[model samples]
Target: MTTDLTAFAHSVFEAQPFSRFLAAELTDVGPDSAEIRVRNRPELQQQHGFLHGGVISYLADNALTFAGGLALGGDALTAEYKINYSRPAIGETAVARAFALTTTRRQAVCQCTVHMLGDGEERLVAVAQGTIVVAAKD
Candidate 1:
């Protein structure tokens, strides 16, 4: 049976309570790729008045996992990941773009970049790489 992956992706995003609480919108999800966005707010900022590192990492991880699932045509979970923050994420919004860089039957390498969008421009904020493991069907 074929799945309507776009609908599935939206459902997955909606089911996540944290994402909902973060006010993240899953803008796009296709085979091997996905994008998410969140509006910047003071609550999401750190002591330095910039987007918190945890928030940035959260965006990358979820976006990458979604891309991995799209690539595998099934559910996937993050095995491990690493991220590097290049600058303070300060902007009116944050966008995360993720792609499945490589895929096997059961594993995928997902990469993501996050950008801060404000004042009609975007600034690169963080980069992440993750390994996602596709779960076997029950």
Candidate 2:
């Protein structure tokens, strides 16, 4: 099931042009959680040499939706989200881990934490909470 879920997550991640461009990888996906990781690069940094806040936010939002989808049993979209930065993200890679906090038939409340990994350690960079709704069938 883990392999299947990870494959499903990868396929969905691959379909997003922006995510693909960022070289984001869906490292894990399970019954109520998901994780994404992206390597740091020059283009993804800001003037201060920290990972851009927008990039962190993107990871948080996407991870939250993926976790919600796992809990809800289908694809999900972020209805809304709020993020708080704890520190500048200075690292070789950024990882986002998310889990469903609560779930109902139509939606899930999820939380995520973004971490910066480098120097044999991880630093908490940001945290987020969001509402994710079932995606409309196309």
lDDT of every predicted structure (CA atoms): 0.93, 0.93
lDDT of 2 by residue, 31-110 (tens): 98999999999999999999999999999999999999888887789999999999999999999999999999999999
Native-referenced Cα lDDT, model 2? 0.93
Q: After superposition, how far is residue 54 of candidate 2 from its true place, in Å?
A: 0.8
Q: How close is candidate 2 to the true structure, as a TM-score?
A: 0.95
Model 2 CA deviation exceeding 4 Å by range:
1-5
lDDT of 1: 0.93
Q: For candidate 1, what is the TM-score? A: 0.95
Best by TM-score: 1
Tell me which residue pairs clash in candidate 2.
Answer: none
lDDT of 2 at 2: 62
Residue-level lDDT tens digits of model 1 in 34-81: 999999899999999999999999999999999999999877899999
